[model samples]
Target: MDIEKIAKAIEMDAGERLPDIRESLQEMVDGKAASVHTPEQLMLRTTRQKLGLSQSDFARLIRTPVTTLCDWEQGRFNPPGSLMCLVEIADKRPDVLRDVLM
Candidate 1:
């Protein structure tokens, strides 16, 4: 086996592969190939943003840990059905949720 030729071939292969990988990443960043989030994940993030609450505040309002809330929002874990129902209610009626929590 010729080591110098093998190394050159490997470098050329990597150079060729990088452009496609970079293009795919750029597409994602440009929202042309955005990753799909589950409905629960979308709800978790949107509800908090609509409520104008930070992750910690939203987690407190929902009686959950901040890390768990982050996990749900990031799609590392799904929120429970019960939590989803509450999130829907919150999304539709932010004032009511706040008033009840108060």
Candidate 2:
């Protein structure tokens, strides 16, 4: 990887591009512009962190194989709609899953 190029890009993003990007994303959130992200792009790592679970624990909780969970986290494959729904539910209402599991 070109470390110098990556560093320059990071510097540029922090110094100049971040504000415009943030504004554009805000506009999209406010319905002033179209979204740049899709629901399917919900990152597995973020969801797992929100649920306060490790990959192994989360995979068990979701009743999926750890290998599958790792694949999702690594972006090797996208989870199906049903799994996505479960992930959304776990991210938004973790208590629901916790309650059900008890």
Candidate 3:
């Protein structure tokens, strides 16, 4: 598709514009960019990590099959809104879920 245009855009000089780009990139590499993502898309892996659970454990916690959880995390299929809401809740308040699980 527009390879030449893309190459040109990438080759453009960084003449003081966005001086923080290098620092920001390094911070992201070091897992310090906490505010990078928007609410429009929730990363399944990130949500799962926030719960401090392994894939198997997370699957069990949500009562979803491991294959389905894997598909959702790999982006093979987007989770339905109801499942998304549960994931978000687990991410934001693991204590609430832990009580229910117990």
Candidate 4:
């Protein structure tokens, strides 16, 4: 079935494909790796504090609830979909709060 010819072709192409695949894979890895954050916790804490509201008030502002916010901050519960999006945007660009919050 011309296996030798096929193998030779593969061998020649593998060098090019491998590096391209590897570079794309590394870029994906780097993109994912960069997402890890601590600022969500900090901002959730600090901004709420500065506003002189308990977790309850922040939760109300976010339209969740005190218990949910507590659970999220304390790591007992994961932030749900919309909240998680807000958290990511907020953490990354806190200066955009007015825009993001809207």
Q: Kindly report which residue pairs in candidate 3 clash with one another.
A: none
Itemize residue pairs with steric clashes in candidate 1: none
Model 4 residue 18 lDDT score:
39
RMSD of each: 10.4, 10.9, 9.1, 11.5
TM-score of 2: 0.59
Residues 71-95 of candidate 3: C-alpha lDDT, one tens digit per residue: 7776667778888887677778878
Q: For residues 53-102, what per-residue lDDT tens digits would candidate 2 score against the true structure?
A: 89899888888899998877766677888988877787888899799863
TM-score of each: 0.66, 0.59, 0.60, 0.42
Between candidates 1 and 3, the lDDT winner: 1
Candidate 1: minimum summed lDDT over ten consecutive residues — where? 16-25
Cand. 1 Cα-lDDT: 0.82
lDDT per residue (tens digit) for residues 9-98 in model 1: 665887753434555555655769566799789878998999899999999998999999999999988889999988999999988998
RMSD of 3: 9.1
Of the pair 2 and 4, which is ahead by lDDT?
A: 2
Q: What C-alpha lDDT values do all the predictions have?
A: 0.82, 0.72, 0.70, 0.62
What are the runs in model 2 whose C-alpha is more than 4 Å off?
Answer: 1-42
Q: Return the top candidate by lDDT.
A: 1
Badly placed stretches (over 4 Å) of model 1 are 1-34
lDDT winner between 3 and 4, please give it.
3
Candidate 1, residue 34: Cα displacement in angstroms equals: 6.9
